[model samples]
Target: MESGDLLLYKRAMFRLAHISDVHLGPLPAVTYRELASKRVVGYVNWQRHRRHFLHDGVIDAIVGDLKGACPDHLAVTGDLVNLALDGEIELARQWLETLGDPRDVSVVPGNHDAYVPGAFDKICRAWGPWMAGDGQADPVGRYTFPYMRVRGRVALIGISTARATAPFMANGFFGNGQARRLAALLDDAAGKGLCRVVMIHHPPVKGAVAQHKRLVGIGRFQQVVARHGAELVLHGHSHLPSLYWIGTAQKPVPVVGVAAAGQGMGGRNPPAQYNLFGIEGEAGQWRVHLERFGLVGAAVLPARIAELELAPHSAQVSLSPH
Candidate 1:
C-alpha cells in the first residue's frame, strides 16, 4: 500500500473499561444510633448476606487485570457502598483514588449507595467530583443526571437511576425530568458526529430486573433513544452479564449489564468480571469489540466476548418493545 493509503487505513481506536457494583467492603463499624432509619434493616442484611458474596480479593484481582490493559477511561456504575453510611461514603472516596484520577474515572450511583431516605445527600457530597456534568456549573456540589464526558469521538453519558426505596424494594427511577434532558443531550451528541454511549445504574430494558428492583419509567427512557439514538448503553445492578437491544432512529442500541465486580464463588451472583470495549470507525460506521474478563479458575484474565457492527445513520429503524 502507498503512504497515503497507509495513513487512511490506520484505525483510530479508543478503549473504555466498564465495571460496576463494587460494593467496597469491610464495612465501617456502625453504632445503633446510625441505624435508626431504613439502614437498620440494611445493616442486618449486610452482616448476614453481603459479606459472603462481595469479596475484596475479587476486586483486587479484577483491578489488577484492568490496569494491565490500560484503558483510556474507566466508567464505574455505582453500588460503591452497602448502606451509604457516612464512613462508607468517605471510604469509597479513598478507594476511588486507587482506580485513577477523578477526571479519568466517571461514576454513577446505585440504589445501594443511596440506601436510605437522607443518605443521598451524603453520597452526593462525598462523590461529587467523580460525577460532575461536562461543562455544566454545579455550584451546589451536587451532580445533575445525564452527565456527558467526551473522550475522542466517543461520548460517555452518565445517568442516575438510583433512589431510596422501601424496606423490601431495591427499585430505581428515571423520572420525566431526566428523560427530557437526556433526549436533548443525545441529539446534540449525535449531531456533532460523536458516538453516544449511555451509562446508567439500572438496565433500561423491560423486565430486565425483578419487579421490586426494576427501573420505573423505562418507557420514557426508551422513547428518548427511539427519537435521538445512541450507539451503546452500559449499566450494572442486575449482578449478571447481559446484552439486549433497544430501538432507535438509526439502528438498535446495544445495552450491556455486568456482574458484580466483587462477587466470589459459592453465590447466586456471577463471579467478578468487567468489560472492555474497543471502539473504532466514524459516526456512520462504527465497530465495537466487547471483551469480558473474569476469574476462569483462580486467576483473572481476559476473554473475547462479542463483536458488534453498527450501521450508518439514515437507516430506517423501529421501536423495540423490549
Candidate 2:
C-alpha cells in the first residue's frame, strides 16, 4: 500500500475508553432540607457503606492510566456523583474537564444521576456539553436521549436511563420513544458505514442487575438491536466486569460492562476498572479488541486483567488471561 493509503488505514482505527459509576465521593455536607427526599436515603447509604469503597484516589488512578493509553475518545456511563447534590454535580463537571475536552468525551446518565424528581435536569444542565449531540449547541435546558456523535468511523449513540426511583430502588427506564429513536439512529449509522456504539447506563440484557435495579423496557431495547443491528453496545451500573452477546447468532453485537470507576480493590464489588476498545476495519468486517485495565491485589497502579477480541458478524470471543 502507498504511504497515504497506510495512513488512511491507520486513521480508520479508533481507540475508545469506557468507564462508569464513579460515584465521586466525600459526599458534600447536606442540610436537613437537602436530605428531605430520596437524597436522605442515598446520603445514609454513602455514609454507612458506599463512601468506604468508592474512592476518589481510585478514580484518579484509573483516569491517569486511561489518559496514558491515549484513547481517541472516552465514554463515561454515569453515576459520577453520590447523592446528586449540587456540589457533587459541579465537582463531576470539573473532573470531566480534567478528563478531556467535551468534544472528545461522551457521557450517559445513570440512576444515581437522577436520584430525585429534579436531579436529572440539574445533571443535564451541568454536564450538557459532554452529553450534547454532534453539531448541537449546548442542550442545557432541553436534553434529548439517543443523541448521536460521529467520530471517525464510530457513531456513538448515548441513551439516558437515568430516572428518579423511590427509596432503596435503583432502576432505569428505557422508554419506547427512545427505543424507536435508537433504532433509527442505528439504521442511519449503519447506512453511513460507521460503527454504531450504543452507550447506556443500565445493561439492556436480562438478569444483569437485581430486580429493583434492573432496566425497565429491556425487551424493547433488545427488539431495537435485533431489528436495527448495532455494531457494539456499552453500559455500566452493574459495577462488575461482564460480557453478553445480543442480536442474532449470525451477527451478534457485543454488550460490554466495566467495574465502577471509583470502587477500591477488595471491595464487595469488583475493583475500579475501565475498558479500552480498539476498533478497526469497515462495516461487515469490523474488528474489535477489548482490554480491561484496573487495580489488582494491593497494587496502586492499574494493570490489564483481561483481553478479548470480537469476531466480526459473529458471537465468537477469544479471551486471553492477563
Model 2 deviation from native, Cα RMSD in Å: 2.9
What is the per-residue lDDT of model 1 for residues 222-305, given as tens digits with 9 covering 90 to 100? 888888888888999998877777875347778888878988867777688888887887886777767777765444553444
* Best candidate (score: TM-score): 2
All models: lDDT?
A: 0.81, 0.88
Best-performing candidate as measured by lDDT = 2
Measured against the true structure, the TM-scores of the candidates, in listed sequence, are 0.89, 0.93
Which pairs clash (backbone N, Cα, C closer than 3 Å) in model 2? Answer: none
Q: What is residue 272's positional error in candidate 1, in angstroms?
A: 0.4
- Once fitted onto the true fold, the runs of candidate 1 whose alpha carbons sit more than 4 angstroms away are 1-11, 140-143, 300-322
What lDDT is obtained when candidate 1 is compared to the true structure? Answer: 0.81
